[model samples]
Target chain A: MNIQALKTYLNCDNGFLLSLVQKFVEELNDTTNKITLAWQNQNLTSIKLNAHKLLSSVKVMQLKELTLSLEKIEAGAASKHISSELEEDIKQLDIQVKKVINDLQLTIEELEANSPCI
Target chain B: MVFKCAIIDDDPFFTELINHYISQVDSIECCGIYHNPFDALNKVNFQEIDFLFLDIEMPEMNGLEFLKSLTTLPPTVFVSGKTTYGVDAFENNAIDYLYKPVSFARFSKCVNKIKAHFEHTRTNSQVKQQNIFIKHNGIHIRLAVDDIFVIRAHDNDVTLNTNVRSYKTHLRLKDIYDMLPLNDFMQVHRSFIVQLAKIDKVDGEIIEINGRTIPVSRTYLGELYERLKIK
Candidate 1:
């Protein structure tokens, strides 16, 4: 996604869009854990499919850094390259997700502190 | 006492509103607020709850189907956005119906009905030994052991004096006397059957309850003295 559009979506106006991002971040953390396990188990199809899905969604979420890294992982899985560099890039993406996730978590906590509901 | 209540609907906003309402209500405590009926169904199947606050339309499983699947039905008060399901909810044995954007007043009304039913059930369960079915006009109502103080036969109908109201029903005094449990209810005369528990004071030709007097007949005098342990 372009930087301007990313800024607009993250503006989140009334906090609704922000909550959806929080939910997405929550799902991404879970899917990343699953993707790594599938890769280690040499389930190439499962690994490729999971990385592809994450690649598309993280771009929508404006986590361009993670999105680009996941696309490489998807390509490496499809070609059965299983190279150490591709593995290191995917590992770095996991750390980046954790950091972005912490940022979203803080945003959610601040919003909830202001207005609590279901 | 808190009753476990489920809030089922597909709107997160409404679910949040319901959660807010439940937190404020004294009698009802929230079990969970679900945005889908399937999630609510999973909870109901696993939990022992006293009541359900179900919404009609859901994605996979609707409220009506969920209510049908319950093996043990707690009293359900349906919450919907419309009134067309009144007959449907009632036919499924719902205790009450609530429309969407539920106002506190309407919610209060539904809870009041559930409160009354629960209170009546608690008292009835304790006094199962003796019951008197009183016919008021065309309606037949069950009066429990603690309800009846005295039964007075007036001309062609039997007058049942209860703590709440007096009902006159067209049945033979003999038939009414026979209907009561033999041990607790004694036919003291042709016109009266006095509850052995409720007779606070007894005197010549008069049987009383809480300062009110009911007449006694000569034919049943022996039975009254026998019950009162009079010499």
Candidate 2:
């Protein structure tokens, strides 16, 4: 994660940045579950919407891998297909989001340990 | 003057990001941030806001539907997560369309556009307050409101007598009267609106202004006397 760039763009101190990333982690976990459920249900609309929403957070976090995966999932919904490939893409997105969430948690811990105000 | 703005979006994260952007700008103030359109409609005095940032997809009502329900709307910028709503936003007269994950630079550009729009509107309003345009001789003429003395109506057109010249235009006397400053102009009869400063004499039934005699109706004579500060 490019915490430096995100911090500069936000113009926020360490505390606000910590909280924002924490919120992102929470939202990421919830949205991943939503997209997975939507994909399993063959709900194209839900899949598309959740991916689009998650894309915003990933973009802001500068997570290029997750950004590309979310974009593909969003577009995949448009094809109205429930093929094995799209299912695999959804599976990969879930794994990547879980990994990112873990990394963000670590970043949060580091920030708290380093900054007394946070 | 600091411009007041509001944000209506379902996503708290997006709204918080925008609020931070607003705090960094010196010329803008965020008056309200709503997670839904329903609360915004009930709480916001739209007349006090210069512009708004709206998200297209919310649970209660989409941005387009919310805007359509209102008779008047401030300038709006559409913030959304997808590219699908661009044409719809254009049709609804959105000032700008921003896709999700907007950077500070992109948001700044939208704010600049809003500032320019408000500046242009303010300049035009100032001009309108001081002058009015009337069509005469197949051409439009700009007449200073201070120079006009009388508006007399014929069957189909009204003649505006100014200090420079009298121009006749096809308009109703009441319609023309509404355009003038109410404190300086008064309708004294069914067909006449005379500038209060130009009234030289207010006799029993006749009023004299600029070497011309106009009749005053009983309906307005008392008000005219009161306006002229005559007992």
Candidate 3:
């Protein structure tokens, strides 16, 4: 993801965007965990709801690939059973989220180090 | 003077984001931020707010539902992630609809709209030098300042009682006070402002004008006495 482009979209400074990114990462972790537990318990309703909520944040961050995967997972949870295709999509979403989280953290650290006060 | 505004949204992040955007603009001031629409209804004085920024998908009451519930609404702009709400938003007479995550350019466009709206209102108000133009329904009816006896404020509405007729308009008393000629008018009470020449009699605690008894609160009594040159 283009962190600079995201900051420009938000019309906020690096520190503020970093804070929002932190919140997004936390929410992503929580939602992924909820989806995993719901899938293990065969609770399709919870999986669908959690995926739907995550889709909003993912779209805000402009993560097209992850958003598409989450949309598919949410659709599957709504109508179809938790099959191998849905499982693969969920796994891919989880991987993408983790990678984004790592990239955001590195950006945050770089921003903090470059600040005059620091 | 900067126009005061309020934000109603359930999401803290979105509120913060909007607040940040508002801080960049010098002409607009964020008066209050409410996470709950119910709380906003109870707390915010709609009469004082010039504009509102609302989110569509809130927890307790959605923005559209809240807008529907209001009797007198300020100019509003809906900010949301869903593009499907654009039709419903305009149906309720929203000034503009902004999709999230709202960029600075989009937000600035909305700000320009607000500026143009207020500028137009100011220009219209200034056009009539001797007469006060009050919008009744959709048309601006010119009422001479000389005919107006008392300006009474109740809730969000203000009534201009003239010698021949009374015109009720949806405008704040303070806003009307600002528009009226200051030399000819004096606010004698928090909810009452009377034409200086229309004062029939000034009693100890009340003033009578054209058979209407208007109370004079202690807070404004001193200024009223000074303005009238009453010892």
Evaluated with DockQ, which candidate comes out highest? 2
CA shift at A55, candidate 2, in angstroms? 0.9
Which runs of model 2 end up more than 4 angstroms from their true locations?
Answer: B128-231
Docking class of 2: acceptable
Tens digits of per-residue lDDT, candidate 3, B1-231, equal 356789998766667778888988766789899988999999898867888999887655789999988997678889876698999988876888988767788889989988777766666666455887899777899988888889999987999998888888998886887687756787777689899888888999899999999998775677778888999
True-contact fraction per candidate equals 0.00, 0.47, 0.30
Each model's TM-score for chain A is: 0.77, 0.94, 0.86
Superior candidate under lDDT, 2 versus 3: 2
Q: State the lDDT of candidate 1 residue by residue for A1-118, as single tens digits.
A: 2333533533333244445555567668877897778867867776776676455346555566777788778778889766787678768877987888887777667656654453
DockQ for candidate 3, please give it.
0.24
Most TM-score-accurate candidate: 2
TM-score rank order: 2, 3, 1
Winner by DockQ between candidate 2 and candidate 1: 2
Provide TM-scores for the models. Answer: 0.38, 0.66, 0.63
* lDDT (tens digit, per residue) of candidate 2 on B116-188: 7765655554534568888888899999898999998998889999998999998767557657766688888
In candidate 2, position A67 carries an lDDT of: 93
Sort the candidates on DockQ, descending order. Answer: 2, 3, 1
Name the regions of candidate 1 deviating beyond 4 angstroms. A1-118, B45-47, B128-231
